[model samples]
Target: MESPKIDIITLVENLAYQQGTKGEHGLSFVVRTSGRQILFDTGQSDLLVQNAKKMNVDLSAIDAVVISHGHYDHTGGLPAFFEINDHAPVWLKSKAFDEKMSKSTGTPRFIGLDPEVAERYRTRFRTVEQVTELAPGLKIVPEIGSYYGFEQPSQSMLIKHGKTLSADLFEDELFMVFEHSEKLVVFAGCAHRGIGNICRSAMSLTGCNQIQLVLGGTHLKGASKGRIAKTVDAFRDLQVEHFGLCHCTGLPAFMEFSRVFEEKVRYAHVASRFEPFD
Candidate 1:
């Protein structure tokens, strides 16, 4: 049988302007194709399940869950999620369980996912070392090493290993690649590893230069003007078709990208749907 065309829908995000469903500082998306329906990033709380209920979405039907990283804002909903769907593999990086914390105020704050919850469903977790194809025309892109100069690893986010704290290189950050309309569409968790890095890694892995859409968070909220401008210029140079940006893409950066991309950019808020042929 021929592969199915992919359709992605933003189920829950940090903002919900018109969806009636509540939003929080997190992200979650539902990617549907003919063979498998995947849930990407479960948001910061059980709110994902609540919002899915409001949208008439059946969480039990999800074939698997693709977590972006170990951050709670993206993985915190797993406990509640697993409750709804008795069983489904959670795909993430191999070392995704590493302890992660942030010290923005010079005081450590836990930013990683709940360990107790993850331990409870450890059997369902799938550790990915590199790019792995989940199904025909669908793949999980993992650990795209840094390639851009401006998008350096954050010092605030730290990981503790054997009494040592080092910058969280975001080795756990990952993205999904799906073939649709003969174009490659990227479903990013948070792009915690830089959007350019992810796009470039995807191209290198798939050997495809044309990216149809880059959907989800870019984590560019706190980036400098020069960096944002350079990023926009880079995408333009890449000839990217559409950008469904949301979450950590700060207001200023988003506006800059909006001006550059025009109607090709849309806020990937809760309930936003990305179906090319629709």
Candidate 2:
């Protein structure tokens, strides 16, 4: 039997591929498979809606919305999304609403979604606590554990507990897996939990070793040389066939990946379209 053709259109990203489409420091994708349209992440603003309009994508037709994590850059367009689509349920992990902070600049800055939006559109959210099948052949894998100590969570990210702050383990982070026979197509957002860990989790959950393609942010910006080397080695060991990385993956890591992966790597910019099963 032939596998279903999955069409992924980049609705928002850090780089614009087309002239009319604008770019921002965020990520979003329109994934079409099994006769359904799934909106994966909504970038950081109304740029999602604007880019969708420019690219001829109808937000009103989305069957579901999957938020990869609670970061504002990934969930900031929820208000705009809900303003347009009234039926599609927004799926996310329970901890996605926790107060997330970033201290990369030595000054704590809030990076979670807007509380007002979360309150106003509370009814639209469907928080999942475990592995869930969103649609036929489409699974949402959450609570990714770090098997590799080198793939640790960023120490600069914190979760605010009232006044005290602690390292954000990113329990709210999740990744999407599209099963196609013995192969899998993984979609990650920022990959705050680590891309290698995300891939391993997907393979373990689905029991599939062949990752046909991996697309999304890796959060490897400013990562240590040792970390990048380990990640590259991990990907090679995982046998990932293709990579469409972007956003926070960082130029250094991208260059290293391209140099190592060669023709197997491609930058997934705004307006980029990927048909993994084609």
Candidate 3:
């Protein structure tokens, strides 16, 4: 059977020209492919829900929901999603429950997933510690592990490991891949594991070098100049043809991306749809 057409729609973001739409400090994408629809990362709040409603995007067709990490900004819409998605399995890393927080030279705040909410949807949760194929052409990848690249985890975020405070290794971060024909289209939510790491891992997962498009948050906000340069180099080395960058990518880094990738670097905001093929 021929592969079903793949369509990605941005339900929430903090960028671009979608009139009469609202933006947020979060990200969410609705994936439709292979006779299945996937909701990738619920935005900060009901922002995604409200936006989808405004755009007349139906949420009832969602076959599954994949969370990128344990951060509140990414997983806060769990309640809203649960109401609309029927009982689709919530996919994420097994460590999604880790106590997370950030200390930015001020009072540290809880940035982890809500225990009460997770408990409520415990039966519908599907945690994966390794790569798992959700369908014929869709897969949820686990941790990207260590990569000695310029894309490093934020130093401010920390995880509570019992009585110890451990640096947030972002073990909960995961990226989704959609394979069509002989091409691979990758989506990284927040990409705390590093874009270079994500690209390398995506190639490894698909076992092919032909990446159709690299979309979603790169989390490169406020990155150093040297780091950004090396990251763009990695993109070039990997031959990433298109990038749909948005959410926390920062103006400076995004500008660099646009300069390097030129027309290949399109900002994905509210109502932005990406169909790499045809």
Candidate 4:
């Protein structure tokens, strides 16, 4: 069977854009394929709505919204997004814990979303605690645990008595997989658990060893050169052709990846777009 064509629109940025252009923190992508509209993740703010409006993306028509994790950066726009449309199913990992944090500097805050926001979708949002296929070729792999000697802890986010704090690292991250014609387009948020682990888990779920495209943050800001090199070698071995790295992918790691992957690597900036084929 022929695969559905996918169109991904970048809705947020972590760095400055063209001259005089500003950057938005966090990440989000609208994946349109197989006549289905999937909102991957909402950035750290409502810039996604603005970007979507700029790109002529209609959120009201979105079939589903998947939260890669519970970080404020990724879920901050949920309240606004929900205001736009409340019909689509909000699929999230059962353990998708998000907490509030202080704005100044960066400190552990509260745990979970604000009451105002939670009330909006309290009855509609659904959580999937296990690995399951949501559609013909789309599957959600929930909390693969940890990777890179780290448990992939995310900040506990919440608001308490008008104060916010970073909560805890409750296992809440997930990755989305799209399989078409035996090719895989894996979508990740921060990839806190480790990009390699995500890919391995995806392979295990789909039973397809080939990863054609990997787009999203790699969470390698503090990674050492050796670790980055190892990651690149793994991608090379896996034969992933298109890599769209952004957000916390960091400068040093991205530069090294570009040098190593060359044509295969694409620095993922806001407004960056691409289509993968085999």
| Best-fitting candidate, scored by TM-score | 2
Q: Write the per-residue lDDT of candidate 4 for residues 1-278, one digit (tens) a residue.
A: 57565667676778646443345768888887778888888786677777777667898999898888776778787878888987888788755544434333455444345546666677767898887666668777785633344424433223333443334344677899888878788988988777888887788788898888899998777777777777777676675867888987899888888998887788777766656662
Those runs of model 4 whose alpha carbons end farther than 4 Å from true positions after fitting are: 16-22, 98-107, 110-112, 143-170
Ranking by lDDT: 2, 3, 1, 4
Top candidate when judged by lDDT against the true structure: 2
lDDT of each: 0.84, 0.92, 0.85, 0.73
Ranked by TM-score from best down, the candidates are 2, 3, 1, 4
Residue 226 accuracy (lDDT) in model 1:
88
lDDT of 2 at 39: 97
The C-alpha RMSD in Å for every predicted model, in order, reads: 1.5, 1.0, 1.4, 3.7
Local distance difference test, candidate 3: 0.85
Candidate 1 residue spans exceeding 4 A from truth: 1-3
lDDT tens digits by residue: candidate 1, 1-278: 65568778788898896556888889999988776889999998999888898888899999989988889899989988998998789999866798888997798777897889878788989888777777677889876856787776567889878678888988888888877555678888778778888888777777788888888888888878888888787787775788899988889878998898888889998988898534
Lowest lDDT sum, 10 consecutive residues, model 2, at 140-149
Clashes in model 3: which pairs? none
Per-residue accuracy of model 3 over 1-278 as CA lDDT, tens digit each: 88766888999887636766798888899998767888899888888888888778888778888999998888998888888777789999878899998896676778889888999889988888888887778889886855545677999989987778779988889998878877888998888879889878888777888888999888888789888888888788786778988897888889999998899898888899998877
Clashing pairs in 2: none
lDDT for model 1, please.
0.84
lDDT of 2 by residue, 141-255 (tens): 8778676778888999999989999999988999999999789999999988889989998888888999989999999999998899999988878878899999999999999
Would you estimate the TM-scores of all the predictions?
Answer: 0.95, 0.98, 0.95, 0.85
Candidate 4 lowest-lDDT run of ten? 151-160
